[model samples]
Target chain A: MSSLDLRNLKINVGGKPIVKDFSLTVPKGEVHALMGPNGSGKSTLAKALAGHEDYEIVGGEAFLNGQNILEMETDEISRAGLFMAFQYPSEIPGVSIANFIRAALTARLAENEELDAAQYYRRLYEKMDLLKIDRKFTARSVNEGFSGGEKKRCEILQMAMLQPQIAIMDETDSGLDIDALRIVSEGVNTMRGPNLGILLITHYQRLLEYIVPDRVHVMWDGRIVRSGGKNLALELEEKGYDWVKEEVAAV
Target chain B: MPATIEKETSSESIAIDRDIGNFKYKEDYSYDAGTGLSEKTVEYISNVKNEEEWVRDFRLKALKIFESKPTPTHWASKDLENIDYSKIRYYLSKGQQPSRTWDEVPDDVKETFERLGIPEQERKFLAGVEAQFDSEAAYSNMKTKLAEEGVIFVGSTEGLKEHPEIFRKFFGKVIPTGDNKFSALNSAVFSGGSFIYVPPGVHVKQPLQAYFRINAENFGQFERTLIIADEGSEVTYMEGCTAPKFETTTLHSAVVELVAMKGARIQYITVQNWSENVFNLVTKRGMAMEDATIKWIDCNIGSRLTMKYPGVILKGRGARGEVLSIALANDGQHQDTGAKMIHAANDTTSNIIAKSISVGTGRSSYRGLVQMPKHLKNCKNNTECDALLINTNSRTDTYPAINVRGDGNSVQHEASVSKVSAEQIFYMQQRGLSEAQAMSLAVNGFVNDLIREFPMEYSVELKRLIDLQMEGSVG
Candidate 1:
């Protein structure tokens, strides 16, 4: 019965407001899609929710499972069951993907508790296989010199491993081809269950074809102006975002 | 938990100079052999060790040269100028002879070595252990199998007395006393260091180790070591050093000379963690004959100032040399370490990779030289030096010299200096690691390539050391 509630959240970057008065509620077993054109504050909202240091919350309140998350450190926020998949993942050279994920998992365990190596590897290999990643990917450095598609797959792999309560994917389909997008979508679909809430941010309706979101919200000018069922994504895709801007201007 | 708490409580009262008496050799050795460049002090040392006339004259000549030469002014730190040579004790050794068994060693010296993890490593896997307390080796032992195979492992003093033929042949040929001011000083009053000799065609599978402990104040420890690998023989040597902290500075000027004969291989590894009050200046060099190989793996962790450059001379055809070095400089420490490679013959190759990290106002510098002679055709050399500054107050410098005279020689040099950026820390923090933990991971990642070259146990200890350095790096 986990949920994330964002109440009238406002976010700014570089002294300019990006997300203004944004509100969203994602309960367990629900998948929400944030649809917008470029520069529509969708990524800013995701980053703000993840407690990124650069995205200053000018006025906002974010909660994870009834616990206020804005006051926690970024790492604490992450350990509190919030995970963000970056549009451009960082390349940590010489740090193996296995070690990095193991460290994150290790941080979550009780101080005196130890992880079973065999079971851990077993789970890791299963996740990698589900993502279609090669077994050798475990030894490779995290996102270092990886292709765009490979980076996205790695992000999904991490989400599968950490199994956070709320997973925010920021433009997860950007630079991904049809094959990669389908694979990444399938991996996410496999992890969707009663205890997980997902917020997928994307610029186009193409990703929606595979993920099949339960709810769609159109963000325009730092605010979610429209919210509806999945039909909203197809309607918005048929007509360009200019139509929405024109309608808003007429109002 | 009780042991850990006891250790913590004991560490609180452990001043830098509290363990001076742990240097048992200082207690029994008479300090009357004062710091004088006279024939008498040399004669006293020679008489005390019962050395032959040739060895005694060698010391006298070295002493004369040491007195005439002035300390170098251009290289190294100016703090070395304050070393009061007149006030330093030359040599100090316990009255007992070098023991082959750990039980025969004095209790104080044995306890110091035990605390340093020497006995544990020896009992577990070491092929031999030579523990030097103060100025002389208190205990020296090698596996009986190695002795039966004609592998000579003993103190330099014992080697001079027993195997003078082999000792006299290659004593100062690689690193002469005139090579540096510190080398000259070491030549004059050098006491106890390991002397290893591997017979022709015999390969020693395990690594021999030497542990040096300096436990007395104002006492200079000058240990000279020599290793000769005969034709087709292979051997590896490891050395670790630690000294008690003292209010007054102590001088440690050691000289190590190695010779690898035709088709032989020699590897030398040194891990030194001296206290902040000690000046560690060492000169180590090796000569590689036809088709021979030599490697120097060095890690410098703690010292007020350290100036050490392990050099290799490729004197025969198809010879090869390599140096892998890592230095970590904490507060008030200066690690000036690098390598030197000289290609004197055709078809020789050499490589140098040096990595250093500086934290908390510490400074580390890489000064390297690679030279290929004009007549040496088909020679190749690659030099890479990188430094990582962990804090705003820390600094790093690189000074590399590459000389290639022949057209057929290929020489490449690359150097870079980078500091840990705030964005990197933020990015790592976003992945669920604390600021301090992020800093440690980044630093470890920075040196991961070089660290993988170390043994598994040493790599683990190095990571722990890096973690300790990163503990207070962040608020």
Candidate 2:
């Protein structure tokens, strides 16, 4: 079984330490949620795990299936079965969404192995139908002039297509309306099964109601100070982050 | 006495004959202007071509104007100063009549054109083929069906000899010889360009193609072309050029005039990839009558210096003109190309879209003019010019002059200059394309809109040419 191990990771951005000594283990067949208040470094942890150039690994290691991911390039890290859905994906003009994703998938294939066009289109159309996206959307430029809901749905579509071993969703529920949120959660739920590990980063417990996680962790000031079952999300949501702050103060 | 002996022995003082053996196509025709321009030379060319006295007088007048007018000193580079008129051969044509079959063409000349893929295009889809070697059209033929339908496709000399009335009517109407010094030179010694006329109410679906090859050194090719599309007629014309590399420079000055009658449509496409030793100065213009349409699709790939501006005059109401131009300049090439539009009647419209790519110290300049008369109402013009520089040493410039006098006229002009960014290359590389492939794709995508306007075969050839230019582009 595949697993991603983050051992005492310390991440820094712009010379300020953000993710400090945070540790989490997501083995295959489990869905984990990291919930925290704003500026608690949840996004930083996700980005650092994804090997974004802006984040520096000052200390500690992140391993994908027992291999260090810190040594690989961003694209290499991606091809090595770790996928991070961006909080804000880049908008590439003049590049169609279908071509972009096809390029990514083509890159993942072995040399001298050509992608079967018929099979690719069949799977693409099926997934697009499931996501309720128009088939004509494949011809439009990548994320150019797309609405917020469209962009989120596009990201989810890519996630579904790539089918990474460890899917890191960084605030996937943000900017989505109620119906869109349900659709996105249902998409995530459909992909949740054996042979896949999920790390969902969110600011509210509302999303946890749909895709309930096996474990919920509370992050405060760049570190996870508490860990509990699914009810921890409900408790934190009911009492607010001030309770966590008061508990830390008591500590 | 000793000095005279030394002068005779030295290479500089002897009066060496400059008639570098005439091209194979010129075997049948007499060399009227052996090597230079004079009143006698103009007279010889006119008489040898059996031109009307009026045409001869026009040539004489143009030769006088050419002799008196000074060269352009203010234009880009002004490298025409080095052209020695006395050392250049003006007119050389094969003495044989235009051939109706490929078998009638001389084998050597036919092989050369075949190597350049001219005959294949004719055999496949072209409605007509005119292959000009040096100063003479070696082969000219049209489909029998087109001939039966009263389509006239022949050389300009033949047109002057056989259809003088129609020839004289529109000879210099669009672009007069006195328009520029090159045009004056072309008029004085012009030979061997295509003459096409479509009968009324007829539409030629397939393209007519002409291939011009310059195989001799220090030779000047001045071909005068005139095309007339009758009412409700449609036609498309494609032309290409290639020449072997030479040490000394060669001069190519051609004049093409087009007339489109009411409800007629004309499309002229040119792909010129001359060797780097040729100076290509061509004048091409078209006049559109009421409800007529004219389009110029020009792609410039190679030349030492090219100064061509295809123009269209909207003289009748509801006339339309369009120009789509693309230029790629490698090392030691300067492509100074653009389009001009003149609105003379009400409700006329024009659009000019041009894209250029420069690499390895090459320079590309866009010079355009759009004018609407004060009395013309509801005329509209949109001009967009973009340049992409592939290297730091390359350069691009845009010079657009717009004069809209009427209050109701609408005009828009936009220009942008951009370079291939390193980040774009890296981004594409991250997606698995090599650096060269990425550059090619980016350059292709940059001109995707204009390239799509070309025919399918031409689009494939253009992509191959762009890919060749992108080779060795990265460090």
For residues A152-222, write the lDDT of model 1, one tens digit per residue: 99888888999999999999999999999999999999999998999999999999999999999989999
Instruction: Assess the local accuracy of residue B189 in candidate 1 as a C-alpha lDDT between 0 and 100.
Output: 84
TM-score of 2: 0.76
* Pairs with backbone N, CA or C atoms under 3 Å apart (clashes), candidate 2: B26-B93, B26-B94, B28-B95, B29-B94, B29-B95
Docking class of 1: medium
Docking class of 2: incorrect
Q: Residue B210 in model 1: shift from native, Å?
A: 1.3
Writing each residue's lDDT as its tens digit, candidate 2 over B1-475 gives 0111122223432221111111222233355468777888888888777778988999999998888878886875577787788878787765637777888876667766765678898988899999998888989999999999999999888888888888889999999889898899998888888899999999999999888888667789888899999999999998888776667888999999999999899999998877778899899999999999999999988779888999999998999999999998888788999999999899999999999999888999999999998988999999999999988999999989898897999999999998887655544443445567667767876787788799887887777767766764555
Lowest lDDT 10-residue stretch of candidate 2 chain A? A86-95
Give per-model TM-scores: 0.91, 0.76
Index of the highest-lDDT prediction: 1
Best model number under TM-score: 1
